[model samples]
Target: MASLPQALPEPRAAGPAERPAPPPVARVRRRRRPSGEPPPLPRQLRASGRWWLGLSALVLLACVAVVATGTIRYVDVADTRVLQAIAEIRSPALTAVAEVLGLLASDPVLHAIWLVDLVLLAVFRRWRHLMVWLGVGLLVINVGAAMATTLQRPRPFEVEVLGEWSGFAMPSLPVTVLAALLVSTLYSLVPPGRKRTVGKWVVCGLLVLTAASRLYLAQDHPTGVLAGVVLGVATPLAAFRLLTPNSVHPVRYTRARPAHLDVSGDRGAAIVRALRDQLGLVVTDVSPFGLAGSGGSTPLKITVKADDTVRADESCVFGKLYAATHVRSDRWYKLGRTLLYGRLEDEKPFQSVRRLVQYEDYILRLFSDGGLRVPQPLGIVEITPEREYLLVTEFIAGAREAGEAEIDDAVIDQGLGIVRRMWEIGMAHRDIKPANLLVRDGTLYLIDSAFAEVRPSPWRQAVDLANMMLVLALRTDAERVYRRARLHFSDEEIAEAFAATRGLTMPSQLRRMLRQQGRDLQDQFLALLPFRLPPVRIQRWTWRRAGLTVVALAAAAIAAYVSAGVLAAPL
Candidate 1:
């Protein structure tokens, strides 16, 4: 037992010398920074600081100079000189040119010219540019009016007016209109290649003819017409320069991740970067929620934390996607899953399905401002390469199944109130299923605003109301639901709504289901028909009964007063 079959010799520990020395550590070479050039400033502050300061100072100086010059008065010699020039050009040939030009400058002709230009712009898909020109033209007119008012200048005393005139006539209307036409025409013809050279010449010729016409018609002095041309040309040219594409800095939005599954490539990395930059969210993890819809909607989830902690009820994340793909099957499924699964505490997905997430946020802000109860919207974030967006909204808690009968009555009433308010604002929630209604902390809230449309028709309003009624009836008796509805609306109005939605057969279907309970709802249903029914008279009879009660109370009070008076008189 002690020998134990001579256990194997204990292994000897290797001497320190026997263990090989650790492999020589590799040294990493540090790259040196370049010596000559300084680090560049951020793009936002790239412009020379002194240049901006100088420019601003110059603008201020120019404004001061203009105000000073405008305030100083001269002897009105310019006005006198203009009258003298008008008197000198009273010849037949010049008169004829002026007359014809004046005729072209008339309101009817000007309107026709504007219409033609508008049509041409629309056809050429240059409507946006055309609108800019039109706005400039209006601005020129307004400026001319202001100038005339400021100068308080009168028209030439020599002209015998053929028509009644009102208001100051220093910057002549004909001159202003003609100037606008010439400038706008030039702007349109130029920069679109030299195809409109003939048109350009025609416009120049017309400008000359119109100036002559103003002189001939004696509606404006030569100087006033000249001033108009100067002002008009200056205005549109300034507007064109200010509004031209070259003048506007291109806004480069970082490419966002695809919201739906992109089988074509790896967009996940790009999406992560976009989420961080655009949405200011640090996405800890991202995973596929589910497959795309048959159409194109894909489902996905993104886990993220805000750069800064957000308010409990406020949105900390925002979902974004291209407007073109927002409602498509692939995008919708992904977006829906994100909203349902994302950790939104008090935020909501926006209702505008056609606008970008940024624009939708703007509209939602407006809705909130208008006292509409809506989910708080968080800023929109783009997930990179995938073009998938994450919208972080206030997560609504305690969402009960719409079909549950035990839903709070106050919640139902609040939902009805929301519908009424929607009607008051000329809107309809097109999708009004119970799933869209949420109850949290005993307060009913409406969600999923993507289907909300403005100024709904009577039929649409009726349908919306009917849908809510149907949903309520599904969980409660029709009689009880109707009584609750009547608290906010008249019986006749409710009946009319039912009639309007009869084609949907929603109310009928609900009533048929209730028929199994032996409830005589046929009378109530008939009362809701468009045709006149005895129930209408019965409703009025109930009102009369209330009136009778009021009269009996008054009589009792009068009799009691008389009895007390007789006893006090000791008759």
Candidate 2:
């Protein structure tokens, strides 16, 4: 395993005239394409399921229109002639093989494949794929039933019926269901690559064999099999491609975070170009930095090439990469918090990735301007418009996490002073956990201002104070931390801070640390206070929360029921 790269070098004292000059930009109208590498596939051609979906819809509409106009008799003649042609060459051995191959589209086989899909998706924790699969199944079932009843086209009358069948055969339900099951499995389970390309041919081959068997046996019209193939395959393929594209919801067999995009190929090159063009920084390498500790965004330590213009001390910089996936994750997380805690102050989801990064950038500048010990805000780099962004800031050299570093009186005072200053500025670092607090040369610096908010609720500010104290006490003791906190916070304020702090109020990292320490840190801090206040009520119920709760419970119940049935259904 490779070691984590070093942090950004500390800035050196320099005169204003020595500011780094802008990087030289070369304008190329149409640079010759690189050799050997294939050109990028267009998005529409890459994810062509939506085109197939539209084609299927048009074909279905044409069939329905022909039926409404009483002109389907002409299509039936074509279907009958095709069936007769297929039957002309049918022999016993061929028929036996057709029957065996046809079983691939049978209910039991389709059901087995469906169940296997459900199992694999569930085992992989792909809730999105599972939900879409279930939705497609329900859609196919309802649509097939409706078409059968409405069209009411019987089996081919021109040829003797040779095989067992049931229900109106205008659109073969078995074929439709089979196509859906196989296509969904291909998109959901198989990764997008050469294997998927090969899987497409296999899917086409299976559908052709099943349709041919039905036509040779006189069990379905040619038109009916065509309709089934269109409906079954197109629906789920379009849904999967549209909803869970491989770019975002990749089929990975690793424990890596989903929001972290690969920054090795085109994206890495894009980042380098964007940083140079937008922020006037020339990068040398863009390897992932501190990925093991980061869960929300991709933390990158960019290495800049040091030249006469660029100082050696400013070679490295820190950045957090934000993209559409992080925006969705933020929305879901905020929604979950709102449902659980009844909108605890500014829980609205961000509208876009741009806004999300903009808010953090604004907060970082706000803190830096207000004399907070935060990283100096460099700037924001646009990797891709509206889809991705890179927030650049100063990286403190020789900094260790506050929890891992040795703490003393000065460190404790600095930590308490940060909370006090935040209260003074009417801002709160909503996440005051150990990870966000960095200690360098006995100076505590606050990072990850993504969760910092202005004019935050008093409860939120108090919780910050409590969380900070808890973190400070992790290395020191609660008694000593409280003794120092009094210098910054009054007795009443300290009581209120502890009172506002509770289970969900503290950050998960803080709570987990306290739990692992096996000590009632909150209680110990409260004991040192002059007086105890009643525990603040954190849960507040509202109609909105109640409705969301009901919806969440209903969705979970449905998922459980479907999963159980899929597992128990007989093949």
Top-TM-score structure, candidate number: 2
- For residues 103-187, what per-residue lDDT tens digits would candidate 2 score against the true structure? 8876678778877887899898887778888898878867886888889988898797777788888788888888888898888
Cα lDDT, model 1, residue 242: 42
Predicted model with the maximum lDDT = 2
45 Cα displacement, candidate 2 (Å): 5.2
TM-score between model 1 and native = 0.36
For candidate 2, which ten residues in a row score worst on lDDT? 8-17
**Off by more than 4 A, model 1:** 1-272, 285-302, 306-363, 382-392, 502-571
Off by over 4 Å in 2: 1-58, 61-71, 89-93, 139-151, 308-313, 343-346, 383-385, 551-571
lDDT of 2 at 100: 86
RMSD of each: 24.2, 7.6
TM of each candidate vs. truth? 0.36, 0.82
- How well does candidate 1 score on lDDT at residue 257? 30
